[model samples]
Target: MHHALAFLALSQLKGFGPARLNLLLQQCEPDGDDFYADCLRYLPQIPGLNAQQVQLCCQRIHNPFHGEWKERDQLLHWLAYDQHQVLTLGHADYPELLQQIADPPLMLYLAGNAELLHQPQLAIVGSRKPTIEGFNDARRFAGALSELGWCITSGLAEGIDAAAHQGCLQANGKTLAVLGTGIDRVYPRSNQPLYEQIYYQGLLISEFPLGTAPRGHNFPKRNRIVAGLSVGVLVVEAALKSGSLISARLACESGREVFAIPGSIHQAQYKGCHQLIKQGAKLTETIQDIHEELAHWLQLPESYSSSSFGLTTDSSHFSSNGLLSAKDSLPAVGAFSTAKNQQAVASNQSLELFTGHSHSADPSSSNMASTPDAYNPNLTAVAIKQKAPSVPKFDNPQQEQLWQAIAQGAGNLDALVMATGFNTGEISQNLLMLELSGRVVQEAGIYRVNLSV
Candidate 1:
């Protein structure tokens, strides 16, 4: 919370950017595996920290953020209100994918289902201006995927993205809406209904401070969240340089999968999808294509072997782009995926960390390595199908702690550990065993007892 307030104060300043703030953080924030906030005695020198900018903003001349308790307290008040909360990367509550982003939001303001941020998410994105076919394509894809229990994620824009959310909801699936504006302000005005529904059904998340307006620049930053939260981002319809294309780029940069639906050869709308396919984005014509991709990805043998990709077994290294690398050479992080696309009036922006389920997937698919029931297909979303009452089974001390924590209303892993007085390692093992038994379900980052338990 302290760091969140400090970040907000810096964000409110006019000249600060990710680069400059990163400099400040490296010098002043927590070090190594420890990530916590402490009071600053003086403003540390950020290579490009602007003195004039601080002065203009009424910050202390030498100690720009010194003793800014009143302002911090005000931010605390906002956090305490309904539809207001904040989370940061590296913390237990923060989304794991956001940590993989090139430039992530330091402090995000979340308006709903703060828990969903920790769940698994998929990003569905496309051009704001799309053809009628694009809209149908987006909705159908989202609905099919949601029916399989995937959380639909998207920027709450007017066209393809909006349709994606509607489809997810119709499938009784969960969705997340990420925004360029503050959590309280719905941009474009036309998406207000979707926005409200997401607030009630899934979640609405943002990096912009409370009451921040939707300016022209925030969308680019918003795109990062759209791409960052998902296992992958799917482009429904886009121009070569459309905002949705930016999301695909961001997804690539973050090492997430990029999928594109092919459009008609004669249509201008298909150009971007075709371009992406040619450039190596996965060609996604059906949900099964995605499922197969995930299944293949999960089936990778732990032992790295280039022969799996048709490369010579004697190969010592891979192409500069890693296309021919040994299977084990692929970074461990690229294994998971996000199934993007859900058509609804709303798109969920919530991101959260999952300690237990992060390594698992729905059992119905062979792609999931950990176990069949290790995770909920809609783990990252809040599917409103009456939130089926779950009963968790506990065969170990760790599993027992997980249930104890939930029974006490501790909604996150950290809280569960604190409440159970157990180390994360032991607790996680217990949770994993419980999940594999299908007695428990992991959502976002929290664990709950499934009805079978």
Candidate 2:
């Protein structure tokens, strides 16, 4: 308790950030015969201890331990609760991965299963205002990954982060929520249920001290911890200027794998992911892609090692570029296979060629002659049924206007924004609705009216 008090005092001292405190601790090794007194005695000798820092340390050492009794008592009371504890930097239980970062927190206030801190974690993050499809993708990926025994780590924000947590929990898997605010307080207030779920089932971790409010700046600093604790980060959907990208960059800098799901190039939500893929981040379409990339770190069970979720481990399916080979013919299944075929074709072609009608078979082609559709009535029916659905009516004037603009050759987000006189956010929301409703199609950065309409 005494040592904790001294450490707490050092943490509160101005100008004593993690780097400086680490340096001071290395020099003095504040232990034995009244550690605080020893720190006061050798404060001046510490290499980076400026005069102001030295004076601050002296003042803290001179003050009685109970001087800030209320705050100290509060922390003690919090720690007294079951499963609530603090991990200092040098402690054996401290996560080694977090310590490897450039600026590790001096202490972490943890709630729930502390053992999870040692488990391999994969961070999933993205936009707070994700499209419905983006939300579903995050949930599906997180749930699948969790079932494979990897712990999911994320901030407890709304949208993608919340969906990730919910998915992991639904799979009865462990997850961790790294907070920008103090563990005692849940920001956004709306996440109270999620906070409770994580607190009871997984873990809640934060570097911020008790009662720290949710300040804007703290989140970016909090992002480093999210990336640091994970073996890799999966970005579902993030705009160009989002915190998810920051986490991805931090993960890259710390030598962790970065994975991004490619989205429609016309959506601003996917711009950051596109940028990441262009910069060499792994392009992940399915859980297999993630599992393959993190195979060495994941240490899968015998079942998973041989195959994943019943999908055959056909190395031939993947191309030299590490994507699914487009040339491989789709297996004859039912509607599921038809959907998979579309995805496979999308994967193989450039974004510009992903428009559903781009690869129509030519009557003069040799393959058309070899496999006559007239010989297989069932296959012909399936092919005809798999054709793109007709466009639906718009829900409102905004959506109608956006669709009309695209139909009028407003081919990009900026052009649509200009043509419809809608701001980026409004345009994005309407476009997403149109895309989801099959009224519009976007490939590469170009928007096209669904000709099937």
Candidate 3:
């Protein structure tokens, strides 16, 4: 208890982030019956610490109990609950992967299953304002990956992060939610139910002191922990400037695999993913793609086999140079043909844990609500029965006419608009929908039929 208090005191010191704290600890080597006495004696002589840092350390050591004991008290109160723990750096239960990061949290406040800290984790992150398709993809991927015995980790933010957590839980799999605020606080109050579920069934982790409110800057700092705790980080969808992209960059810097899902070229939401792919991040289409990359790190169950999931190990999806092929075909059209079908697949594929939900920033009926009947398990299989589109089909005569015009000689958007007599918006929307549905491909402002579709 005394040692814990001393460590807590050091953690409370101003301006002493993990990196500087670690360096100071190494230099001072504070030890003995009176740890504060040792700190006061040795901290001043530490070579790398600036004068202000040394002064802060001196002040902390001189009056260790000066400030509020609220943080320590709250930690103790929380610890009295079942399965709650505090994992300090170098502790036996501290995760080795996190410890390897450049600036690992000095301590983590953990609730629920502590053993899960040692389990393999894959981080899933993306835009807080994800598209409906992006939300479903996150849930589906998380569910499938969790079934393989991998724990899913994410910041307890909305959108893709929430979907990933719920998906894992639906599979009766473990998950971890790292927080930007205190462990006791759940940001975006809408996720209160999810917060409780994870606290009891999986784990809730935070580096923030008890009662810390959610701050904008804390999330980027929080992103590092999300990446640090996992073997890899999977970005489902994100804009060019997003916290998800920050996590991906941090994952790469830490020597962890970074995976991204491609989205329609027309959507600004997908630009970050395209950028990541261009920067050498792996482009993942299916759970099998991720499984192939992390197979060595995973411990499969006795019943687990490649054949169980009908996963193909062939690398044809990727180029000979190991990157995703530039000419790689888009996802099958059946995956995104209708909103109903997308909802069915998202719900049934992941067992309805996060069915028909959207956490977009601008929440509205159009973006957040889905058909109430879409949760039927058989509906997903039925919806996918349609043969993959070999030749793109359009229900609207205008879209069909526009597509035919493009297929013939009118390849550019302007030419298509002129040939079909449709307005520019109509042509652009049709082209985008076709590209998203895997029937059309756009290159250099020219549209072409996807022959491989």
Candidate 4:
């Protein structure tokens, strides 16, 4: 059996967590192959194992196929899919930054691009109901950073998380959605379209085992992976008790940089960002603030430099062009592939990541939708794409004026106010009407025409 499969079996033993599994692997030193028999032989000699513990270990090692992993077959079935993969702790392809965490997961289930796990990631997290301004900020920052070769990572929740992912997609950039549920499941059901988009265009990650559901406790656990996978975390908009705050704290604990966008003192949504700023997170207003801070890390040794993140050195990171290639830093293509598997595609294009599944048949074709109803969770993927959406006719000249302003790229609410010579209330009312009719969408207080019509 493959070592990963053997580790999966060993991982199923009761009482065998990541720490215990690490200890067992260290003692057995199973590099010679037949890890199960080797672990069985070493179980008796390893210290810290009582007689009963040793006996149980031996039983598990002797008959790993009969171990307690109820989902072993399910895992095998998932792996049979081209893009579905499991990276064990000792797997050569496991993310290096994730290994630095205090309690790393034994394995990570990956969908979409497994190679993206090696890319430089910046986590954007915030409240599920952030103000429109906050939503735009997350989207703008995500898009900007993606252009700089950063893979935007998020929990895939609503509000700020959705904006960050959408912005990255819009920019034709790389993104990773770390799920709180199993890799197979999409929670909130409302994000089904977003989930499908990432499944085809970006990466979906989870440390949870197969068949896991979205439980309250699972989100905090998921936040750690979001932080661990990133070089930094940015809290776009969050409440004091927000899960985004938890991700920021975890990033700090993991030695990753944390950035927070400051908001008004009176606003309830900005309180957590203020708290994070007070806790030494950088006060960020623009992407330049983030670039300056992370540039310091580029000065570190090769082991800690941006090259280690599988990101090439651009003009932003280096004074000269092409100082380093992303391919130079990452493992060769097909490192984790089997004989039947085709070679993984390179991440040379702005949007293309590794191609592990049949979805790679044409990676350049984008699936972005331009309307609010495009993400109607009730609609299937084919329905969303093939359905002839009705365009709402506008009888109000003011609403048409506002829509035209947004379509022309003057998306900021204040900008729209200036361009249309309308008061704040008038612009707000017309924009709301446009949004309601699916003619426009707003984020971070910026309104844009929705092309679905």
Candidate 5:
């Protein structure tokens, strides 16, 4: 049988989960055409498969197209439709990032642009019933980031999720919805229109069977996929027990960046965000705040680099390893290269603002928070000097160290990694923050001290 059919049959096995299925799949040759036959032949030898499970697999292999999998006809029908596909775990198109997760789905049912799975994605997740302000914040962030070439990924729930998808749509940018229900189903019937739009303009993805209805337990699995597929996750507004926090936790576990927008302490809905901020998720206020952290990790699209908002710096100074070298000096991107020149630029030229969230909390609110040794997301520049030894006039010793490193010609990720003994993620986050704040400049991939700063 075909690999997808084999995976579908194996998935229907009563007790087999992703872990055991993955273990079994590992033993089968990925390139083989008759994967079901291989699974049946190797069933007894596969560890953790009890006799009953082995017999069931053998029976299914003997009758690959037997009356098992009531949803098989639906799956086949969906697969035959335009732009519909099923990506098995071992499929080349299966997302590498999702595969890295602890328990990846054995298969993903996808609609719309399957190729989009490979693009840079940022997940925006939050409460199902959000305040108007929170809803607007979701839209605003999603729109801004979408214009910058990010594919916004979110669970297709109400409130924040809907707003995010709408925002991306408004920007005429790509957005993806990971469904808690099946790929063929749209929950909350209210979003049926939005679902149609995404099906044509973006992508719809799910790991559940074709007819799986929305269930409370199914969402956490959906949440994991949303978190797994993105390079970072932004929590707009969530209560203490919100599933958005779950996504943020999973993102943290996956080592992806987590950003939380802070709201008033009195607002119960924002407590989750505050809790996340306290737990080392970056305190995000502006799009620049997100950009400050994620810019280094993402390859900005050509439109972003050439857009009015981009800095046009020389690319020739880039080293063979894709990092900038310190040997050559290049002109800064646009007039913002210098602090004085930045003042001359029109105020309208400034980055867009999402005003629903504020930064009123004292930086010291993180007193109970544990600092991650590499990058402390909640640690502000002001608190850095207080937390660490004073480095002359520099307010942030980490930034100061990074600046000195760049000044000394350690210009790339690898160079900084070797020079400061910090990991790539730490260096990337810090360097991007410095660049966004105008204290440092990057030409091509190389980093340098902004003499004007």
Candidate 6:
């Protein structure tokens, strides 16, 4: 790595942040040997990136931050810290668009194939609680864009974000996943598989350092990176109250094209897209529109010619390793399943986990209501809140008794399970079955009886 890359890597540490480090690094020669020696004099002028933090970073180095011993040691240790790579703004590997942004990340932590960064890319963003159709749209658009040589970029979130990555991968395209957490952590835990896939195929990037976990504030920070990496962005589906719209607006501020796919007049998800269309977002329906809009930069025919490429839809989806395997073994496309029922699951931890029901909530039903019939419909994120867990089954007498205890609120599930004196296997199986039957509800990590008759 170059000196700038090393300096930037050290700067990614806990206290040696980009903005402050940039200001500090400028005080010394960009290629000077005395850079570390000059550090102590400049330490007094820096703010936000405290001296102690610098001391911590320098300590690992032999010389340390020149009398800011701790700073030097920490910087040294930071310099030694591996696993992540740092790309400077002027580096050939740095994305030119990102460097031009209002606040480009001085040091980028990239964990995938660097070549993906070279491809022209489009941003695809939408609600974390997108509908199945919304997910399908994101995937299809991303896949199509990928085929057009556009790398896909998005926040590594659930719903629309994952859908976009999955789509690009299905088309055997490149992608980039920016996260709100450290490269080591995957938020929502359920997205682990998707995260792994993207890390292996596309690129995983973050402005945050190696150990940062998700904070509510970290996400908005991440959104900027998504907008910065792409030439334009498309909003597939989002509600008026969604963050994807925030990203789309950011893309606009960055001088990138903003496009939205219109939805039904009656859908809440459509509102954000419609609002953007009115705000001058290009209304897009097909990949051709995006390719056409970006023609000068993306380069291509005004319209796709059969000679440019024929649309070939086969079972050529990629498996875990980022390669298209045999046609017969591909898993079903994310679009085949409707999110209408997906809301019925969440956390992947819930024995009765329901993201939302397969059907939308009655909206007319009270919080404590139960299904008049054993079968209630699916739910929607309508992302942060989770539905009550499902009661999987009540077929056995011992299991039924434990279920009764859980529903009646005799105690929490753990306590009831203990009191009812049931084995964990039987208990979990019964609970999951009850959830699937819609007879029980789990929420706030607690299980309750659906009381409304």
Top model number, TM-score: 2
Q: Per-residue error at 238 for model 3, in Å? A: 0.6
| Model 6, span 228-328: residue lDDT tens | 88999999888997888888887889899999998888999889999999999999765545766784665543533311322223324323422222221
Per-residue lDDT of model 4, residues 256-295, tens digit only: 9999999889999999999999989999755556766775
**lDDT values, one for every candidate:** 0.62, 0.71, 0.70, 0.69, 0.70, 0.62
Model 3: colliding residue pairs: none
Tens-digit lDDT string for candidate 3 (1-453):
545556666677666677667766764543445556766776666555577767754664576566655766777787788887777775666899999999989778898898888999999999876765676577667876776668999997877888688667766678999999988898978577788889888999998887889999999999999999999999999999988999999999999999999989999989999999999999987676787889768764453445333344557744453333322222333434364334333323332222222222221213432333222221121122221224456767877786666544354443465567789788888888888886767532335555455
Distance (Å) between predicted and true CA of 66, model 2?
A: 3.4
TM-score of 6: 0.60
Give lDDT tens digits, candidate 1, residues 1-453. 545644555666665676765665655543323232221323334445576655433343224356654655666777787867777644566787787777777777787777777666778998776764566567657865664446889988877778787667654678999898877788877577778878878888888766788898889889988998888888989887788888898899888889999878887778898999998899875554565554343333455332222223333433342222222222222332332222111112111111111221222333323323333433322221224445444566567657655543343344455567778688777777776886666543334555434
Instruction: Estimate candidate 3's alpha-carbon lDDT, on a 0 to 1 scale.
Output: 0.70
Residue-wise C-alpha lDDT for candidate 5, range 1-453, written one tens digit per residue: 256776776777666786676667777866567666677777677666568867866775667577655566777777898999889887787899999888899889999998889988999999876765676578767866776668999998977898788777755668999999988888987677789889888999999988898889999889999999999999999999999999999999999999999888999889999999999999976565677667655664333333233222345533353222223321233533454233222111222212211121122232323333342212222223334522334546777778766554354454466567777687878888888877677643335555444
CA RMSD, predictions in order: 17.1, 11.3, 13.8, 12.3, 18.7, 14.1
Error of 6 at 159 (Å): 0.5
Best by lDDT: 2
Q: Model 5, stretches more than 4 Å misplaced? A: 46-53, 66-69, 301-453
Tens-digit lDDT string for candidate 2 (55-85): 7557756673535556677788899999998
The estimated TM-scores of all candidates read: 0.60, 0.68, 0.67, 0.67, 0.67, 0.60
